[model samples]
Each structure stands twice: as structure tokens, then as C-alpha cells.
Target: MRNANVMTASSEGALCSATRRIMLISPMPNRVRNLLAALTDHCFDVFSLHEWDDGMLDSLKPQLVIYDALPIASQPDAYNRWREQELQKASSRMNIPLLLLMPEEERQSLENKASVHVMRWPSEPEAALLEIKRIAERAQDVYDSRRAGESIVFKDLTIDPGKMIVTRGPEQIGLTKTEYDLLLHFITSDGSVQTREALLDIVWGQQFYAGSNVVDVHIKSLRKKLQDNAVSPRYIATVRGAGYRLADQ
Candidate 1:
């Protein structure tokens, strides 16, 4: 890792409650990097493995290692085989989460694997973020399961309408007030779609004229912390003629 990029320990101080050390294994795949960048204001320590030294197996520990969607190769068997080798021993931190972004078709083959969580790539971004949150939650469960030697399950991520906290699984996703309210509206619509207008109405409280794109900005912010894909999905379906919905997966 480059010293210029890594913050000094004194500057880092204690990890903020909302902050985490995330090590991403792939290049900014599927616009997911934008989402990670979105988290900068919230105190995230995001590092792409491409930026790490070969000694990652021994140093530069992180709370999670995300393996994002890559361009599909002509040979998937050879691809996955080679992929496995990279992950097999690189992460010595056993508790760290491994979030794998994949196509819906390829997801099943890796479903039974231990410690790896998969989200279908190529869905609209709305669905991707929901799935990312779901995956983060799942990773937390896996961590807990190993620690306590028990199985675990989670419902759609829980957002406290009153407390402003979003609990994805074992971890509480940190959210700014605006981002939290936006998600609350998305989840509370009973799976119904909400238009940009509706989102503006709910989130900004009373609409004004003019194309603000404010909704788009906030959505971008939400997507990063959730580690969502802009193209594929598991929740938050985009209704081209309508708006966005928490779709049934």
C-alpha cells in the first residue's frame, strides 16, 4: 500500500462507528467504485487490492474483501478456478467478509461455498444496493455463525423509522440523515414503486419545481455504503415507465 494513500494512524484515530476498513479485490467493477467513493464523506477506509502489495496475505488487514463483477470470460471453469486460488489464502483475517458480485446465472454455482456472499450483477442499481446490503448482512451472519457455532437468518434489512439506524445483518450500516430517510421511503412503500417526484416529496419534504437531480445525488451516496451495482439487482427495481420499487426477488 502507498503511504500517501494510507492515512497516518494518528489521523485515523479510532475507527468511527460508521467507518470500516474495506479491502476490495477487483478494480472498480460495475461502477461499484463510485459507491465506495460515495462513502468518503462518512469516514470509510476503502482500499482496492490492486493498490495493495503482494504481501496482503500477511499485512493490511480489512474488515471485508469485496470481489466485484468482472467481464465474463470465454472460459468460466478456468476463470472460477483461477479466482478461487486468489482468495484461498490471501485473506488471513478469517472474520472478514468476502462479497462476490456476479451474474444471476453464475450465482448458484458459488452459493454453497463458505464465507463468500454473491449478488447478481447487471440488475439496475436500485436492486444492486439492496442486494449489497443483504450480502453485507449475510457476511456478518457468517462471521457470527463461526464465532458462536450457530446458524443465522435475516429479513429485509431493518431500518428504524425512529432511530435512524439501518441494520443489514450483524452490522449496522451507517447512514446520514438524508440517506436514511431516502431508504426508509424505499422500503416502507410496501414494495410499490416511487418516482423521482415521490422520492423528492418524501426525502426533501415538500417538492419544488425544476429538475433538481437531488434524488440522484442521494441515491448515489446510498449505493456506495451498501456496495450496490448500478446495473443489476436483488431489490430496488427500476420501473422504466414509473419509478423505483423494492421488487420481489
Candidate 2:
């Protein structure tokens, strides 16, 4: 696999704080270059991948994936089928939304699916970028509105609130009710420090009085279950005199 070509909006001025991360997957070198050029002015961190790799996908943790499917669509039926099967498997394993670009003639072969947006290939760069922006915005909106009912994904961890289950990668890590609530609060804190007193009020309820060390004890247990190191945390981070916050990615 070719090394991913990264494009940032830093050339314009300061990087946009809300810049979205996009992974462009295409076997065609020219197409990848063209798309990267088109996105240069946008507030997006584009990672152009010449070939699809789930390992890279996990590592990148992009907000959206743009799969240029024209090459595969033009292949022999058997070859196309195999490639499509692999794509489906990779997509199924992640919560990131997909934007598929295919020829108009080949579009009919594909089915409509949730979180998968389709657009015709050979589109003008302007139109393609607009559609990509729209899909990314829509996906974010859906995630925000349905957060309580849907799975919350952060890096490699996934929390299914509906099921009250948390998984790191493919392995499920069991957590008690308090531990689960504490972790959920941390994820939703949006990197802000959560004071121990505030955490007690939110997770343990205002009426439940506890010693100063109660939050620390549960946090230690939660960190252990998440396999996070307090010294070098992947999920939670200490703030010295301040409370805790979700570690920066």
C-alpha cells in the first residue's frame, strides 16, 4: 500500500478548529491526486490512500471515507464481486460514514444503505466536494441527535449506550453501572476537565454524598477495565491539580 498523502488547510491561515478528517480510497493514482488538489482549500485533513487497508483505517480514525469505486466497477464481474465483498466487510467493522463514487451505469448494481452516500463518478471537483461536505455535516448531526440511542465511537473504543456495553477494539470490557456512567460522562465532556465534585453530582447524584477519594477509586477501576495507563493514558488523562478529561487524540 502506498503511504497516505495528507493535505491540510494550514496553507490558508490557521487550521480550522472543527476541521473534518477525510480518507480518500482509490486505486487510481490520478483520481487520488485530483481529489486531493480539490480539497486543498477546504478545512479538511485529507488522507489519500491508493489502496484500502482496514489497519490504516483504524489508525487514521477519519470522520468520513470517500471510496472511488470507478476502477472496481469497470473490472470483470467476478473480480468486482470480490472487491465489493471486501469493502463491505471493512465498512461493517467501523462506524465512519462512506461516500462511494461509481459510474452512472454501475450505480444501479449498488443498494441504498444507511450511512452510505453515493455519487456519480467523473463529477466536477466543485460538485464532489460539496456532496462530501454535506454528507459529513449530516453524519455529525445524526450522531449528535441520536447519541443517547446509538453507539458512541472514540478512536478504537465503542460504547453502545442502548446495550450499556463498552468494547475496546473487538473485545468487550465489562464495567459496573457507576463505572459505565463515569466513562460515558468523560467521553461526552469533549476534552474538558471534569471536576471530582461535578462528577459526583452528575454520576452519583447530588444526594449521594461521598468522600474525596470515591471518584478516584472508581476512575482507577474504570481505567483498569479500559486498559488505560494513568501515566500514559489513551482514554482518560489527569490534569494535575484540576480534575480529569478525555485524553487528546
Candidate 3:
């Protein structure tokens, strides 16, 4: 029952709203340290954990999980068996993808096991990151399909178009019609910068209003409703000189 050590790195200049987030977990501190060093400048939002934490999996809602299965010195066989069971449960229950890194010897034992995918452990850090990227992209495609018309999930925020609902964590945030429409535009163009003029045209259905800060005003109001700070936004970020884009988180 050791306390978990956690490290999270969300890279700057990364496509904030477009990339899939990943959670990395291992019991060995040295292994976790090495992997974090390798992923120093990677784009994806990575939340690394050493030791088990029950609340982490649900709270993060990561698109992918990378489990580095270094054998525990105390009880290698029993620990791995338990981990396999827990991972299988997480995969089926949450529909979250799981990638396991284990020794070649363990592969034979895991044959015909549940849906957990495995890669030989202790590969070069770059190679591991590359494989993780491939899996995450594939998983993201499936995630996108399931979320297509039902709702949009970005970090902790969920926007449901059908119900005209917007929530941050457990609380529902009310928005004006215009604010909701504007937010929807930002979600649809997740990775792209949307200029104020562009937003005005799309959201307001008008040409151009010279020197009018109508877009800015609405954006300010919208941020207030979403509990987002324009200066240091959690959802919508003001891209100086470029306009606005949703924060990747």
C-alpha cells in the first residue's frame, strides 16, 4: 500500500484539442523515471504513475493506458496475475484501451488472455513511444466514431449537442444560445485557430463588423459561463494575435 508517485506532462505547441491523452503506470520507480525521460518532449498529454491508485483511472479517463509490467521483487507471479485481471476488467468495463509491456517469457503465459495487447518490455524509449502513438491514433478513431453525434469530450468537459448541455466535471454549466453555438464551433474545429472575424461570420451569420468587439465580448461571456479564465483558460484559450482555440489539457 505504498503511495503512488505521479508526474504529468502536457507539452506546449502540441495540438491541444486533437491529440489523445495517455496514462502510464508501473510499480517500479526506476522504470517510470526512464520512460518519463524518453517522453520529455512528446506531444501527447501523459500522466505517469508509480504504484497503484484506484481513483486515477476514472479521474483521468485516458484514451490509452501503458502498463510497464516489471516484475515486483516481492511477489512477481502473484502481482502480475492480479494486474492482468484488473486490466481485463478495466478494458471490458470502461472500454479503455490497454497496452502491456512485459518480458518475453510472460507472453506465452498470456496467450488467449483477454483483449490486453502486449509488447516486449525494456525496448528503447523512442520505440515504445512510437508504438504507443500508433495504438492511440487507432483507438482515437474508434473513440471519435462513438462520440460522433452523441457528445464531445475534451479533457473533463462534455458537450452534448442533442440536449444542449455543457458540463465541466460533475456540474452542468449553463450557456446562452449564442455561447453554446460558439463553443460548438470551437469543438468542431478542435485543432485549428478560429479568428474573431471567422467566428463572427460563422456564429453570427454576417459579413464583417469593423472595429466591433462583438466576438470578443461573446467569448468573454462564454468563458465566464464555462468557468474558464480568458487569461489562463481551462477550455478556450486566447491565441494572441491568432484568435482562439480550445485548450488540449
Best by lDDT: 2
Off by over 4 Å in 3: 1-18, 150-249
lDDT of 1 by residue, 151-198 (tens): 322245765554557777778889899887667555533343455765
Per-residue lDDT of 108 in model 3:
53
lDDT of 2 by residue, 144-218 (tens): 645658778888988888888999888999999999988877675445456676677677876887775899999
TM-scores for every candidate against the unseen true structure: 0.41, 0.53, 0.51
At residue 23, give the lDDT of candidate 1: 64
lDDT of 2: 0.73
lDDT, candidate 3, residue 109?
A: 62
For candidate 2, what is the total of clashing residue pairs? 0
Question: Which candidate number maximizes TM-score?
Answer: 2
TM-score of 1: 0.41
Candidates ranked by TM-score:
2, 3, 1
TM-score pick, better of 1 and 2? 2
